[model samples]
Target: MRLTNNLLFFFILILSLYSQPVQAQSCQELETWTRLVEHEFPSVESKSVRSGSLIYNSIRFNLLSDKYFIPVFGKPFEKVGKLKKFSIKVKLTKCKKKPKFPVSKRLDWYMWGVFSQERAYNDAVKEVVLLRQLRNELPSILTKINSPMVTNDDLEDFAKIVETKFQRLLPSEINKLEKAIEKQYTIASKNQLTLAINSLKKEEASFDKLMIISKFKTDNELLLKKLDQDTRHNFFKKLAYLKTKTISELVELEEMLLPNISAVTFQDYAAINTIIDRFTTNWYPYSNLPRVEKLRNYYFELKTLLIAVNHREVIQQIINTNTLQGFKNTQEAIFKYTFSSDQIILDIKSAIVLKYRQLQLLLRIASDEVQSKSYSMATRKKLLNSVKQIQKYERVSIEGKNLINRALHKSQVLCNYIMLEELKKITEPFLSIEKKTIGDLNRLKVKIIDFKNKYKTCDGEVYDGCIKAMEGIEKNYK
Candidate 1:
């Protein structure tokens, strides 16, 4: 009789804990804020509002604002102009429920959102600063680099090669070269007396290289004169025409000898200096600038894609892990308040776990879209193969697996999003490809629906259905 009484007491205690109700959001502050916003921004329209199980109450608003400005004149002549402003109105209904979540938890979410936005904006500013610095440094560096001294005959031949090979380079390339040369000359002229000795040295080194390569050493001065007469436009045109092999060979020679050449060894200095000079005059103006810029842009694009991919992966991981942990934490905390059965806690835990798995799958799909955008076909194929090798680790319950399928389906849609943006960049005039991409995305949506339906049919609320779906979807990627 005593043992039975003890068991009955324990059972009732558990029931009492499990039966407690969850606290709801406090409506007062939210209602006040909504009213204030509506009053201040009268033109904004609030379409929907919802408070989640968590602390945040999200309100969607469409806002329209009008700008008013006055033109001012320094002198007596200018007339002021008036502009009309239009605004759209949105309103949020006041919430009645009092939020149960702690103020600290609510504050954390708000702060995180603001911090994330600020960090992204700061990073963008840094990139722009770096780009500007690189642009500014380019011209002076080019001038410091010396060009190879070539004979009149060689110049004529090189010019002909440029005309034939680099026909695609526009006249603007020559204009840029002229501007660089003029800038260098202007700077040198400002400090002419101080620069005279260094200029002589440079000229002598250039002349010596010409002498070494020239078949007619006696006509050195004449060759130098003729070369100087050649316009920067014509010089760059010739440079653009040089074969890739010639440029590579020149760069190789300069790299090997540049370190050993000192002012004392005039011949070696001249030889290496000439190659460096050629690289600046020919390579910089024609090939190096364009190629480097193109590669940099490509790298920037790749980095951006990676950032988006990484963000999705990180957020998904956090959401999945944190949500699962949150569920566990909630159950433990609420055990004192709710006297529900162990079965109820177990069911909630299982639901939370399944939700996490679903979220993980969704994130994986989003990541895949970024990979597809940045990676080559062969690389993507290899990556997919690697994923297949790890399939066993990813397998989960039927519902979990179904969630994975849905995630993978969503990933296909994400791919379309990335591809659409990529195509816009590649296609000069935007092609009518949006429809095709949209169709592909729609198919993914249909697949997600199917996955959800199939997931619902699993026998147990938290069975092997999720795992099976995950495995099936993994196979598709492979």
Candidate 2:
């Protein structure tokens, strides 16, 4: 009867406390809470449970001063495995209500360095979650920041605000994280450097080939040739354009590295420049030839012949001795032309055409292997040299053709300069014969273009057609 009366009174008291609304604040009394559990609770224990499960319990409190300490229990001991209660004496302080989330700039100042140095395990994990959430949000916030500079001072304030809302990090963990970030940056830098080196090498090769094929080495004799005012102007204008192209290419190759100055060094730039200087020289300008389909067709045939002959030579060498002596002999044969100083330049031009053809064949087969990045450096270099030689021959052959055409054009122009004494002696004006000769030469050029497009060689069909077409053209004037 007495127990029943006491239970009724206790029930009434719990109902009275439960009627009030709970208001969260900096500190609150613990006694105002009503019990949810109907049964007795297990006590905090030091010993291993018979069930082999572990449990932890916590109670929080407000600090006694602006900065203060209170004793709180810590971890358990291993010996005896008995249930034991402990009193841990350590400094414990309250954090500034863990600051309202999505804290403003002003709120950050209020929370700075206000949290204690220690954390309960659960609280530390919550702090880490809070930090990560803020870090994720920072990018957008940083973008919106109105300051001319989001200075280091602004960053420091942000750090303090974040730190005070979380448990303190140990020194060792901070060191490990810094090292990991540094390692990532280092790896990225090295990859960038390697790609740059390879791309630069390829670009250098292209520029080098341009110089090798270019006719910047034109002799004084050609430069000193008497040209009309219009011809002289055209020649100088073309030369200027060629020089501009060379400068543009150099600027482009050097500009590729400007963005990577922090990662690549001056010494690396110097090495690249030295390589560029070595491979390319100057391009010889082509004369403003008339746009004739027959002439262009012949040029295509010339290119075809260059490639086919080179391929045949390579096969022959492989089948022959397959020895270095054979290669030496082949090289000797390519440069075998003998010419006297007073000899026609046409005779000397033939040797270059032969060498160009051989190199063209080598490049046709090897270019794919080089670009695939599967060949040795030495192999790629040899391939590039062949391409350079091919370009040289192309330029040389065109130059030869232009020189012959120019001589023919000059014969017609020279009649205007002939004096009265020489002019009266001739039965016909020299210009008349030269005009007829140019028409005959143009006809021969057309036949040459038509023949080679099908036959693709200067011999056989080319020889027979050429002899038949040109017999009367040269004999009348000679």
Candidate 3:
């Protein structure tokens, strides 16, 4: 009976412990604690992020799927240095009707968390700040570098920054950035070119300036080619204007040198030719410009003047030759030149005629000497040879041929006279023989016959005198 009573008492005590009330959990409490889980996205730092379940206060709590702990682990309390903890309360509740399962126990429980929702929000704020910085800084860099002094390298550096530093931006934003950079670069480059051109304009127009212009042209070939037609013309016009000024000065120098061309030294002649060559080669491309056209006119005029001067020199040389052959050659050479001034040709022809007249006078004086029997046989023969040389000259005018022929005939007559006089002298020695020997008479007759035969074509007075003298010798010998 004592054992039965003790078992009943123990059973009564167990029943009381089993019947204790358990508190029910609320959805609001679950939500408030669940909010502590972080929404961590994938990244380089996220890859190295510590993972797995949490062990806090010696209790193992598995992380829900797709959730992660923050990198710094748990958040701390706002005012205190203690780690922040979130707790959810579970309370027991009776069903309004029948329960699905009998309550086995009763208790009020708590679940704790140390979590936050600020990390994702903070990352978003940083992104917005970075976007603003890129948008503002790129244009700022471009604005700072848009001066006339900016180099291509500076523009290129900005381009490199756009490519490298803005990789995190959206593709659309990156494209806009690239376009902005390109536009700014163009403006900057144009400013630089304009400034350089203005500086060039202030310089004196000289060969040195031309060389610098040529170098500038070569260096900025692409930029210059891309200019609009009017702008291009204006650009080259300034260069052409400078060149025109230089060419005008050169033309003045050439005018100053023109008077000396007749006696120009070899060095001076070469310099003139060099200047002429540059007139053709070193001019700018704005040919339609009025100043350039004026320069071209000056070049042509100078060329014409030089040609006329050279023609005059040639004509003077021909006159100085003092020979009909030289005059004939001058005529032929003149045919090859396209005379810019007809007066030049007319002057040369007139000078040649005057020279011919002078030569004719000289020949007439020699003829007078021959007709008067003033020169020896050798001198007469020399005059005849000179006349014959003139006759043989190629391409003489008909008048010149007639004059040469007349001179030749007069010279021949003179030579014939000298020959006849010498023959008369030879006969005189034989004519002086006192008495007539058969041999002397035979010699005188033979001489007369031979002289008559040799003088068959001769009709001049000297030939008649020679025949009469031989007849006298023949009569004396008889």
Runs in model 2 deviating more than 4 A are 1-13, 24-478
Worst 10 residues of 3 by lDDT: 101-110
* lDDT, candidate 1, 1-478, per-residue tens: 9999999997885554334321221233433423332343333234222233111221111000000001111111112111100000000111222244232232332223222344533443343344334335445434442132222343344345334432222234333544444444423322332232234334422323333333222433332233333443343343333333343444455445433432222123224334434444543433344453443343233323332334334233334443445644533432321223444434544554555555454445445644555533333343343334334444454544554454444444443443344333433222324444555445444554554464332224232444354435434433
For model 3, what is the alpha-carbon lDDT of residue 46? 31
Q: Is candidate 1 or candidate 2 better by lDDT?
A: 1
The Cα error of candidate 2 at residue 273, in Å, is 23
Clashing pairs in 3: 22-92, 22-107, 23-91, 23-92, 24-91, 24-92
What would the TM-scores of all predictions be?
A: 0.13, 0.18, 0.35
TM-score of 3: 0.35
Task: Give the better candidate number (1 or 3) by lDDT.
Answer: 3
* 1-478 per-residue lDDT for model 3 (tens digits): 9999999997785554335432222333332333332221223113332322222111112122111112122321222122122121112222212143222111111122222235533443354455556656756765655555666567788778777877545445566767766666656656666887888777765657767775776788776665656766777777667666665564465456546544544224345455545655655544565655665566445444544566666555666554667767755544332344557656656766666665655555455444645545455555555655565544455555666666567666665866567686668678577765898888778877877776555556777777787788677556
Candidate 1's displacement at residue 40, Å, is 99
lDDT of every model, 2 decimals: 0.35, 0.35, 0.52
Report residue 167 deviation for candidate 3 (angstroms). Answer: 3.1
The TM-score measured for candidate 2 stands at: 0.18
Error of 1 at 268 (Å): 86
Q: What TM-score quantifies how close candidate 1 is to the native fold?
A: 0.13
Question: Mind giving the per-residue lDDT tens digits that candidate 2 earns over 93-156?
Answer: 1212333322122121222222322233234335444444544554554443323343333444
Which residue pairs in model 2 clash with each other? Answer: 208-279, 208-280, 211-281, 211-282, 214-282, 214-283, 214-284, 215-283, 215-284
Q: Which ten contiguous residues of candidate 2 have the minimum total lDDT?
A: 84-93
